[model samples]
Every structure is written in structure tokens, then in C-alpha cells.
Target: MAVFRSRFARVLAVIGLAAAMLVGVFVGTASACSCLPGGEGAKYARATHVFTGVVVGRALLSGDPDTAHDDKYRYLVLNYRNHKGSAPALVGVETAVGGATCGIELALWSSYVVFAQGDASDGVVETTLCSGTRLASGGPPVTEEPPTTTTPRPTALGGSSPACPPIA
Candidate 1:
């Protein structure tokens, strides 16, 4: 009876240790994509291109044709400013294929307010879930006010820069 109790105690201890290790592993893993807290205004300041448009089309592009995993999703934007802009009418926006990389999945034919950043190395305009892009249905009502420049403000770390552009 004493031996049985000892074995049972060991088993319970092992199970508890395993559960603790699993929880630790999961908690550490989930810290991969950490975003700082900010509002849409802050997101607008970080973005290079801001537009409201619908996803007219989507396609997967592969760096190597022989590879099975296509790299990213290329979305075609249209139906805005009478389908005209200083940028192309049909702009191709690239995003990672999964949310694990802070990627966004824009539904075809659905409109969204996109806050995109220009990739300096590749020169491609891209957006992510962290960029404050949202469905147009839930976005702020469109106003005709032009963007007004505000006094530059210091960042949390104590550097000054221009304020966010007003949402159109």
C-alpha cells in the first residue's frame, strides 16, 4: 500500500510538471507578434498610403514557380475617386498569407479603409492587420475636409515628428 501511494504521487508530480511546461511554452510562443497600443490616428501617421477601396481581385505570387508555397496575397484595389488616383486605378497591395505575420485578408468585393506602408527595399505598397485597416462599413463617416498639418509632437521615447493625417 505504501509503494502504491508513492507511485501515485510520482505520477501526479510528473503530470503537474508537464502541464506547467506546456503552459510556459505556449505563453512564450504567443509573444511573437506584439503590437503597441495606439488609435487609428497613430496608425495613419505611420502609414504611407491611405485609401478606401474594394478588393477587386486577388492572386498568389510565388518567388520560385517550382515552389508549392506562394509567398504573398496580391490584392487589386478599385472603385474609388471614380476609379482614379495619383496612384494607379488598380493598385496591387501585397500582404502576408496568414495572420501569424500580422497579415490582413480582404474579402473580394468588400470595401475597406486601407492604411498601407511602402516597402523601401521592394517599393511595394503593403498593409497588415496591425496597420488599422478596417472594413469600410465600420469606418468613420467620410468627410470632405482636407488633411491639416498639426504641430509636431514628441514620441513616447522623446523624438518629435508630424502628427497623424485627418481621416477623410
Candidate 2:
């Protein structure tokens, strides 16, 4: 009787541990999904103007391989040049595509799109705004040459000279 009782207690402890682990896994997954804009049903709302920046990193693709069809999705890290004069800032977003295959078709670094805009605070641009299908399968678009300007001599000896001063 004593041995049987000990075995029962051990089983109960194992069950409790398993339940705790399951709960932890669920919570972690829920938090990650929630971090995405629009919760689970987020979709593109309207078109908006957005400045383009260079792709500073490679795209990441993920999805289940055991499905009937091997489905995959893409995510990109963009370095957006906030204002006309500021340095580029790094931003990451999940590439929105109808199916896994479409996501794979989109180009990485060299490609630019008018993606559906999202809240600026989150730094995520929804896939909806990605307009102007992929460009040629090569480098990024040609950017206009920055206007040239002549520098003025320093007014005082000890003062710092302005670099890339505004064009008159």
C-alpha cells in the first residue's frame, strides 16, 4: 500500500509539471502574436506616402514545412532615412504576401515598394502598401545626385565648421 501511494504521488507531480510547461509555451506564443499590429486580423487600411530607404540586411523566411504544400513567409529589415538630412534608422517588418510562394518571389535589398503604411511608432510597414511590383533583378533604383554647394570660410578661428551645409 505504501509503495502504491508513492507511485501515485510521483505521477501527480509529473502531470503538474507538464501542465505548467504547456501553459508557459502558450503564453509565450500569445505574446509574440500580439506584438504584431492588428492583433491577428490586421490588414491594410489605405494608401499613404512613405520615404524609401536601403535594405541593410537579408530577408528572413519562415513557415511550416510539413503542410500539404511547403509554405514560407518573408520578413525584411529596412534602414529608412527619416528626414531629408538625417541618417538612416533600422526597422524590421514582416513581408505581407498572399501566399508563402508570393513572399518568396519578392526581391530583397534592391527591391523597393510602396507598402501599406502602419503606425510610425512601431516601425512596421504593412505588406499591403508594397506597391510597384519587384524591380529588375539587380541593384537598387538610381537615386538622384545630391545637389552640390560651395562652402564659406569660417567667420571665427576657434569655431567648428559646418559640414554639408544647406544649399542656398
Candidate 3:
């Protein structure tokens, strides 16, 4: 009886440890792509084009010459103005399409400020998840607006910058 009790206790302890480890792996922890925290100036400098636009179209690009599919590249069509590069009313850009891939997620008709690089080989623009392509703030359109009194801004302590900078 004593030996049986001892063995049971050891097994219970091992099981408890395993359960805790498994919980640690799955509880409130998810893997995500690491992106650079780029300021507006830095992102603008790196990007070949920067503009506000709406994602109007998307399609999965074929990798194989024989119509095989690959998630590494997806094509996006955008309608934009405030011409930063050219005067194109519509343009296509390459992006990533899967969990393992790295590119901004775009929904149809969603507005965003896109930072991208132009691919000379295909004459297409390319953007990544980390390339500073971000959703436009809530407004009638994605266009810029003048500072409003309703806007919540951090008050300055003295004659310096805002006292409370926004958190990341």
C-alpha cells in the first residue's frame, strides 16, 4: 500500500508539471512577426512611394508557370491620390498572403496609408507588413484634416513637447 501511494504521488507530480508547461505554451502567448518601430520620417525615407488609398482588389499570385499557387506573393490593387510617386490613379502592389508570410492585411474598400517600394523588374509596387502600411483613422475619408478642438492632445508641462506621449 505504501509503495503504491508513493508511485501515485510521483506520477501526479509529473503530470502537474507537464500540465503547467503546456499551459504556459498556450496561455495568452501568440507568435507574431517582429517589425521595426519606424517613425514617419524613417518610413517615408525608406519607402519609394507613400500615399493614402483604398484597397480595391486583391488576388493570389501564381508561383508556378503551370498555375500552381503560392502564399508568398499576393497582388493588391489600390486607388489613391496625393501623388507621391506618379500620377497613376490605380496601381498594383505585391504583398504577402499567409500566416507565415509578411505583409499588411488589406480588406476590400479599407483605407490605408501605404508605404511601399517599387519593383523595377515588374514595374509594380511592393509592400510588407512592417513597411508602415497602416489603416486610416476614423473619418469621412482617409484624407488629412486640420487640427480640431475636439482632438484629444496631450498637454505640455512647460514649453516642451507633450507631457504624455502616446503609448505604442
By lDDT, the candidates rank as 1, 3, 2
Clashing pairs in 3: 103-129
Candidate 3 Cα outliers beyond 4 Å, as residue runs: 2-31, 61-70, 73-75, 87-89, 98-101, 120-123, 136-168
Across residues 2-48, which tens digit of lDDT does each residue of candidate 1 receive?
Answer: 99999999999999999999998877534233565767777766776
TM-score winner between 2 and 3, please give it. 3
How many steric overlaps are in each model, in order? 0, 4, 1
In candidate 2, clashing pairs total 4
Measured against the true structure, the TM-scores of the candidates, in listed sequence, are 0.56, 0.33, 0.54
- The top-ranked prediction according to TM-score is 1
Which tens-of-lDDT digit does each residue in 58-123 have in candidate 2? 454545655433333334545443322222255554453344322324445654433334454555
Q: How well does candidate 1 match the true structure in TM-score terms?
A: 0.56
Which parts of model 1 are misplaced by more than 4 Å? 1-31, 63-70, 79-86, 119-124, 141-168
Error of 2 at 44 (Å): 12
